[model samples]
Target: MNKSRIFRTLLGIAIVSAVPTLAHAQKANWQNLDLKSDSTFGISTEKAYKELLKGKKSVKVIVAVNDGGVEATHEDLKRIMWVNTKEKPGNGKDDDKNGYIDDINGWNFIGGPKESVNFETLELTRLVRRDQARFANTTDANVAEKDKKDFEAFKAERAELEQKLAEAKENLAGITGFKTALDAVVQKIGKENPTAEDFKNFKPSTAIEGRIQGILIQQLEKGSFKDFYEDQIKEGLDYYTRQAEYNLNLDYDPRSIVGDDPNNDKERFYGNNDVAGPDAMHGTHVAGIIAADRTNKIGILGVADNVAIMGVRCTPNGDERDKDVANAIRYAVDNGAKVINMSFGKAYSWNKAVVNEAMKYAASKDVLIVQAAGNENKNIDVENNFPNHKDLDEKTIASWITVGASGPKDDETLKASFSNYGKNQVDVFAPGVQIYSTVPGSKYKSLDGTSMASPVVAGLAGLIRSYYPKLTAAQVKEIIVKSVTKVNHNVEYAKGEGPDAEKVSVPFSDLCISGGIVNAYNALKLAATYSGKSVAK
Candidate 1:
């Protein structure tokens, strides 16, 4: 691909097949399986729960999920929702006086008194808008020496944003046309939801009909045709529409509802108490992966049982603001959150200094920040992902762990194709592809991204903190990083650009800092050794 096309593709989320196999067998939740007995790619949570935590006393550990939003009232999450005991519900007052009013569940920074901002511009777009007027005609002679660097950065971002906007418009037009034709074929078939057998048995009367039939058949061979049409395509259309209308629009400003100074770092506490904002699918899934009800028997079991999930709504559907992220971290830390799981990221940050200060504050309060290594399928060492652990001076925070995604099969294709990796930046790898977790409306579904992998590690961190209450945040991070199950072999990884991409053999260990996948059982053993606790023989 060319430079423009590469930038366009990277702007969107990377979607990869979770299960690369062709067989239509009932899939197992291999992410939670015990590798010792199941011989599958998993974190071994079952083994740790049955063997090590059988007779152990549990302690309540609070894990703050800082994402778009979380359905705290979901069937699997209601009982485990972190309640603010100090503050009374619906009293119209700050009962606890912790800089928030009526934070019974948590606080939402992206919403106002009555409305929530669902979509916002990307960081790059925001930067372009802010500096375009000042740097539009900047020259070496005209621009001040101090402002020359910022002017150059603004020019680069504006160029990239313009290219991405053009590509999004073109892609949206193509998909819209395709959807219209597919709807006509569906109408001709006289079935709103057609099965694979129906498509196979239908007699094509024209070349377009035959071509549509072939496409549907090929898609059905991978998974459900219904899901491919209703969920994937529909969501893709919405994503592209949003990208064109909101993400790339320089005139769009969703921060007016919050009614705060976006550039001010000292201003804090200016949002409403609606923690579970308009969309809660992503945050709800992350929360379920960490602490869904295990004994309810309604949905799948979460990794930890003694976890109180504190929902801090900071991220919107688009790129999250740096000011909100900084406040969210401080809010979680001040509200007794031991582990904060941040499942959202972007390519650029307008105010990284404030975020770094918040991270420093979290570390000072003994809070560990677990972040997702982005799903760009590119090394993060060369590319930039915002809200990271690295400070401006290139020093990393001690209580942070950056997680990458891993796949099911433990062979040459062990690493997830869509997962972003860096030996120095990403701390560990976990199961992220096709993770079945809780969604909105008390439902469960499978989603893929490094966003899913971050919570798996966060849940394990919560588990260790619950069992070993004396372990510091830094110690917990160290134990998780050091206890990874090393995969020392060459794997066929997807390389090169789009369409021309090919599988190339590379050592899996070089992808991440731990050089292995995370194992809950191994983490538990290491925790026991660190805390001097005896394990079951």
Candidate 2:
């Protein structure tokens, strides 16, 4: 997830992207299945329809996908897109005078008149660069009183930056060396593009040669793209290289392409209306999870019934700016989005106050914000995960939900291996493993992350709001939390940091506040009792 928060997941090299692999024409809706009959820990969506909502009616509910970007015109998404009614399409003028021209779909906070800012420096990298000029020449003794705290942060960031840079370079060397050896094996086989059969049948002279053949055979057998050299590993090479070159580079900056005043955080009306910005894979999948065309019967069915997806692009290839996130939330709320799915979070925040104020604004307007608990396996209670609900004093926000990833297993693997968990910070868990949903270009594939889980909950929230119009955002959150199907088993938990952390057995209830996977059937029943409204909107 986190097209906003990408990190290491590679063979031995620490790759920067958690790119979801392609699912070879998979049509299984395991996320919407039943636990008893299907043996899958799904949301009981199919059961909800047959048992409770068979003849019910629902009103339109707008669920804003505040993520990297979305394919608004995909075959499964075009019908349910949020169209800006007041603004005219293609006139080049702000017909609604909302400062964004021709915003027929939604606004893109990372875009400008001619282009969009695709990749940006992480908040850590930005901090290092911004403070390098003043702190590079000073030390603990010479730094001023007010600047002491900032100087300490700068030192920490600089050190972390150096370590990560070294690791990246080392990892890149390993990948390149592997490819060089792979080429040697291919040359010996006399095949330009070696197949599984070629690698399996060929005889190796040395032990190192046998190791290379074994690795290639394993990669090709994953059933992903067969060309491991060109498709899978090559993509990893390019991604990690770009991450090292741009995300970790202090000299590279893409903000100038957006034509914004760099010093100001108060500037709100800067980005253009390119809602589906450069890369739409991540956000498009999130949007499809909420509500693709369920009636079409051609592709897969979505989670909610009457959801209109509003794409508010903000997240980039690297960390998203706090200013963009704050503006994206405000834009969605002002434009009548009832539920916002923010499938992105970072390890640090440059300006939390602005985002806090925007969250408050959404709360004041009755817009519920759903966020991911990040992909790091560490407990967020000890580590930092931004865009959380707690204010400066640790007081919780009423209408916010922080989700963790749950899988199809019933035992130790119930929680996704890489999901971040917290009993206080994370609110609930949902299906996030091998989740089949829409990607770009009318295509479908299975992806993983709390990014996918968040939209499932958001879609449920939208469904509840659509059917029970009398329910408040806070009430919907309460019902969802209270109605989860609790887990009664202990699961393996990573007790510490680093790769070789000890695995301890802990009750699944201790992972998150809800202690279970979300159940849409139970939540709808709870909503009916709480609001004294059911079946119709």
Candidate 3:
């Protein structure tokens, strides 16, 4: 990454702690923070303390996380998780009549309340099957041409997946071998609970120690892979096992377990209320971000307080099918999830109509969908991404908002290098870069993506709704748009190996629709003035 760009982006900022100084206590108002201070360039979370987040109640709202399962029992996320009292745990009956049998908190659409796949591209498999069937036939001109194009696409995808699978397998093997050897060494050496670092520091008389040292050293250098351990290694094995079972083999009839045809539009009522799945980390983390209890000091503070996190596990490690997302939306809407946080997307969509109809369904229910503007650094205006409802039609959909990532520093580098952007495609920018929030396993970690940004905004919207409750979804959208901190400061652009690259600085306003970072404090404060009597608060 561009260290200088990052440094400049953060410019001058300090961490916000529990005890506030007099100067810290008296934070600049939002208007002043935007014009004079460079803190906005730096995400200004500390500045957010004084400027935006100080006086607000932890708004109670449930934001659905539709991604990989979260570590449900993480240290920081346990207290505030949503629970469904009506449904009995591990019951075979559909107690709620919501179609899902015993969904306690949320439902896993991929696993079907039973067996599911992992990290597999169902779309690629579909395309692959179609191509293979056509390749065998002496087809007509149009059929042959289409088949050729499809074959090329499939070939590329197959190559990528094969490489990824190979890598996963290799890594899995290495981890397994290392763990076995380490286990033997630890037994002989009379040690236990040795971290990778501990193993590295200790000198052993065996070749296994040297190999372990090499792996540990390599891991330490990467920084991002530091969390690896024997247990994590075993988890990796499970991941690969599922990958082999569901994704690679393409045995995607998981719906039979739930006793519903996933492909059939009318057969939507089958899943049970087993929200936690065998594992429920992803949805839990996403839920915690929206409504984990604040100031509990147990795990982490969520953006909103009063939400009932409705877990809808539609995403696996790979591409989520159109049907899953569509049905997930309908489920959340039907079950009273007012704000849906979709931190997932895919490159290829076989049935746009299914997703589009789901989007409309959510809209008609007066639910707002906060979708992540994908993580590719490229501009999305040129390329069409699946699950995007508004950009395709000339007519606009007001219920959906596409969020882009912004770093803590409020400058050009503020825009996350990985976040996809388009002047018209993305709705606004928010603090998605280096965001500290809840993760799986009852833990908290700082993740960076437009995925993080979407929920922050969703949480803010929930806050508005919690206090005002009567604010229409459209009105909430307007309130957020009108309440942004518009900045026109000159700053650097994307820093990487490319033409038109360098410190080619420009006005920050050119970057996004509002040209300003999201500030919950300002939005709520402004909305609070008009919130009287009109809203439910």
Candidate 4:
């Protein structure tokens, strides 16, 4: 569920549109605009900066982006990257003696002494590979009492993998058949890219041809045949193919490259200094959303202006390891990061104990942790999501914010179509749909998911911390939570997908704890007045 939603495309817009709606779906820097002023459901970031934080003296705050990897050298991002003044650049030694060598920006646990891991099997697949040795040959009655839970879990994982593989293959077959049919019709049309007019002018000789023409004509009304084929069909092929080839592949193992003991949660300090790993796109976009250079005059302005981005590369194309995530959190806190942004999550965990220890460590340091509520569209209160603030002892972190995605409108689409929500679990909602930000290679692109939503809250957290340096991490969370723009209307919540998708009119209060979307203008106003618990910076 984690990696499957990470690289989701905007092809859904192009596929259903009458002409191409891809360009229309994107609104540049809409997340930072004022909702009332701009008629978009944004964070009102610009209003806060102009009214509350414009001339205020502030201190620099480091916000760690704990995700795939970040493009630190991006045109707008390079100047604001957290530089390790204690370490000498490109040297072989740990100048600061922090265990990590030459960590100019941050650390990458995904990397080892030689190279980094790009593709990894899902946690279910990893569990299968590990537990299959002991439980594969055993039956329900043959297992010992102590090993019963593990044996049952192994069985469940194996069954899930089988089902996933079957579904992937079935979806792949459907897409392939559709592509074959589409190609045949395109060949008959004799046009590289057909339009609605072309489809209407050419008469269908057969029933299948007529059906194909009808479908293609609806698509061409908003997009071209090329757009429909590439966005809808090819994207599906890639997704299902990846599920079969890498994510669900039990034989594939990429952990040996890291050369660390997966069972040893006590083991730390075993990764390389290459924060920008093989895939920096996700993390780079996350960093930009949090604090892209505000005055760069090169690209879009980030939510926060004066802040340092600490790139802690932990997440990859797949579910992040708990050991790596724990280490990443400790490293960021130890390296002077006051706020950490986690944009990736999964439904399973390999080792929650280590991750719990790291969360406690971060909490002790008064660092606010902000994480996405995931893109699964399932309520976390009923479903499972890993790396949550709750520890092994069931004690939740005091300075944690769980964010859900909201769109650019205050209507039914206000809550993003794919956002996960819970009245008790999720803290607030933020702009996450088609958010434009810095990508790898000094480029930029718009991406969707709660991954984008977490950074928006993280940016606002950084902004508050920078301006109100005396506020504790808990107080910062309090201000952000108590100062939201309340929504008082009923949203037509779709319970399922497609024709069977029932649109239930539910009050926005049932979505998340805050019962509203995040507003920087309101949060800053509350932060200025909030002084219950104070800390010296």
Candidate 5:
């Protein structure tokens, strides 16, 4: 047989019967789990909880939540939160001497201390301003060439903004319609407060009522926020309205609302201590995921029971500024956070140096930063995502782990269709599909993305750090990477849509550097070796 035929034969054999190495068999046992079962074993979660908390020792590992502000007082989260006792509430003094006054937990970069801003629109405004100044019909060849490129980029952004605004408007209209129908139904059947069972019993006459039922069901799935739809609905309506108006408009500038010269990267000492900004949904949800009190049986269990979720609100409904992300990482590391979870990212970054500098600083402090790979599902090695450590040099600076989304189906096809991937860019994959975790205002919701995946890994990182406090950041990274289960399964890719059916399965080697899926149980077992400690059970 020729070489090509021999290779084909080998490939066929490999696909037909998996090459079961010892590690593969161990991982295979984990893959056999019935994901639909209530007591379904999450190898990572179970192992971490058991090994890391053997004696139930109180280990407070702070995980900085850098996207949005978290709800500090959720029923399941209140007990585990890290409160800044040095800074007295509403006293207007910088008691901790950490620059920001009254920072009881963390700072809100978007809202600043006094005002709010839409940072993405601010970047757009800057681009527009540059285009206007450079392209005002001077007819200089070189300058005109630069201006033309800038103008095209600006135009693309403007188009995107307009399209997003239009979509938001349509969504808001539907929400408004359903909300109107919901108000009438709740008033008639539920009086002031309505439960899921109450809404089920409530009758609907018009087509709008059916839509209202769907909306109510969605709110119910969020776990709570049923009794406060009047407040939650209004708040949501207002948020979407603002997003459509300011964030979606190419001309609008919310930077002025925050009183900072956004174009000047040097003017950084602005934002204040209002971590829980006008919108607390994403931050609160993230906080609950990392550190919600375990064994509460009230809402949901967080990944790390011993973690202190520090909410540094820097992201809005749109893109997070590089400056805010960099500063937030620095703050988290400096303030004693061992692991920082950045669940938000964008395709463009203006000042890459600022973010890179912060990443380096975090590395020096032995801090591990977990980032969301992205939601675009495109190969990231070709396209760049911001708040990343990678530069044109094609190298990551430190213990920065970029995570992709994984579905419950233990097959390559189960990967979330929107997850971004790259052999060099993304570090690993984690459970990110339809994850039931914490949200804001004492609620829980099912969200999907590498955003969810990053926290899961962060929880695992916290577990490793909790049990083996002596292990370094790099050691934890090695343990997690080495413990992952790698497979060469010929699985499905990008679900839904058509029959031409694009199916691609990466060789286990191509998915990430470690070629593995994160497993918390094995990480702890490995951490024991790294720390020179005996493996416990």
Candidate 6:
């Protein structure tokens, strides 16, 4: 067989293996529909808006979406964006004197006047780099007793970076080779966009060609060959390449562009005014889930109609810095954001103290913070995910609620396979699997992750605060946790890693603190009762 034909066969096998298996159940827009009436696993926001909130007076609530960035000009999001009235738009001045210049919408902590930091080194990599002098040459004899833990951490992180770098290089090579082979096939076929029929009709005399044909036919059943190879494969190759070049590169320093002391948490006011930075897909999806325009009839309705989304861009494609996260929290709190949605988390936290202090500040200001419980599929009670509600001494933050993703089905796979669960760490479950929300440029997509789940809870908090203005952030957190729809049935818990990992039967209630999924109607009812207010029946 020819070398090109063999490569094509290998490429076909690689592509087929990479494709995710389709779920047996049909896809449903269950996240937006009423759970009670529609028999879907939703928060019942539709029912709440239709039945309970008919004549209720709503107060405008500002929600801070502290993620990558947000599309302030998005058709469904523009009208509902929180504008800094005190600051002058288009004028190069810190009119509000809040330190950020021209921050008419919000602020971007990961960008500067001329540049934006999209991909960055992980926290672990940074930590290893920072402590290189102290731990690099020190052995057990020379290492100080107090520095023992730091030394151990440094060693572990170094090993992790080395392993990750090797893996990323391997992945990049494989993806690049596959793409080249795919391009060769396309050229040989003499089609810019080859279809399944074309591949099927083409007579393959060689064994390798026959194998390639079979693989293409299999993939075409799921999606078009052009889409699979051009879009998905290209994206994978780019991601792996970036991971090898930036994320695992110990010498890489993308933070210098921001020009802020990352170690100094007190240096809070140093980021640019471009809230919607280079990438806003993640943040826009999160913001739309919380407060998309409801009356526009253009996109899907948001969880809270009377909300003004404030974009405080901090998170990047890689893990967010603790200093930026802390500053983002303070900015949101100072700018009158009652609810802060953090749809991001990382395994390691280099400066947990600073982030905790910021969380305390938000708590003091009575601002509710909803964080994703992470998508690692691990029990977070044992393993840690950063920016959690718990303090170093194990005291929980009153204003914080960590959310896990829940699927549409109420059966064995009730909890999302990728969702991180914990009876202690994770507060509640929410609709996150295949959640349809607005992305960048006014487009809508169904993305899965606990990142999506956190915003669902954040939107609920926004809704509760909007109707019941008297309730404190702590009270809102309590209402959300206390009003979830309890699910006592057993669920198929993820036993290992990946989609095809073995699943073990575990009770759904054991997955989270609330032992239930968040319900908007129940939360609203609880809010009304707690505040001694009447709702429209």
Clash count, one per candidate: 0, 0, 40, 6, 8, 0
Tens digits of per-residue lDDT for model 6, 247-313: 7788888888888887777887787888888888889988988988988988878889899999999
Clashes of 3: 40
State which candidate, 2 or 5, has the greater lDDT: 2
Candidate 1's C-alpha lDDT? Answer: 0.82
Q: Candidate 4 lDDT, tens digit per residue, 1-537?
A: 243133221222112112234476746889988878899889999988888887789899999999888888999899999999999998699899999899999999889899998887788788888899977678887898999998888889889999988877776676666677778888888999888888888788877678778877776766567766765667667767767888889888788888988778888888788889998988999899999998869887898888999999887666788888999999999999999999878888888888887887888898999999988778888888987654433223567889999988888768877788888889999998878889988987777889899999999999999998889888888788888899999776668665467877788889998899999999998888866655322
Candidate 3 vs candidate 6: the TM-score winner is 6
lDDT of every predicted structure (CA atoms): 0.82, 0.83, 0.61, 0.83, 0.65, 0.81
For residues 299-410, write the lDDT of model 3, one tens digit per residue.
5566665666677777765567777788888888887778888887766676788888888777788888888878766567767666775444422257777777766554
Question: Candidate 5 residues 36-114, lDDT tens each?
Answer: 3422324356554554546766567888889767777778777877678888898988888887777788777667545
**Across residues 1-537, which tens digit of lDDT does each residue of candidate 1 receive?**
000001212113321222322234224466788666887788999888898889899899999999988998999999999999999899899988898999999999998977988888888888899898877778768998899788778778889999999977887776676677678888888888887777888788877678778777766776776676755456656767888999999989989888888878788979988888998889999999998998787887899989999999999878998889999999999999999999878899888888998988888898989999888788887788887655533223668999898877788877877788888889999998778888999988777778989999999999999999888888888889889989988877667667568878888888988899999999989898877532221
lDDT of 4 at 424: 80
Candidate 5 TM-score to native: 0.75
Which is the better candidate, 1 or 5, if ranked by TM-score? 1
Error of 3 at 490 (Å): 5.6
For model 1, what is the error of residue 368's alpha carbon versus the real structure, in angstroms, after optimal superposition? 0.9
Q: Which wins on lDDT, candidate 5 or candidate 6?
A: 6
Segments of candidate 3 deviating more than 4 angstroms: 1-60, 70-79, 83-92, 113-119, 138-259, 390-396, 489-510, 529-537
lDDT measured at residue 105 in model 5 versus the true structure, 0 to 100: 81
TM-score of each: 0.93, 0.93, 0.72, 0.92, 0.75, 0.91
lDDT agreement of model 2 with the native: 0.83
Which TM-score value belongs to model 3? 0.72
Between 2 and 3, whose TM-score is larger?
A: 2
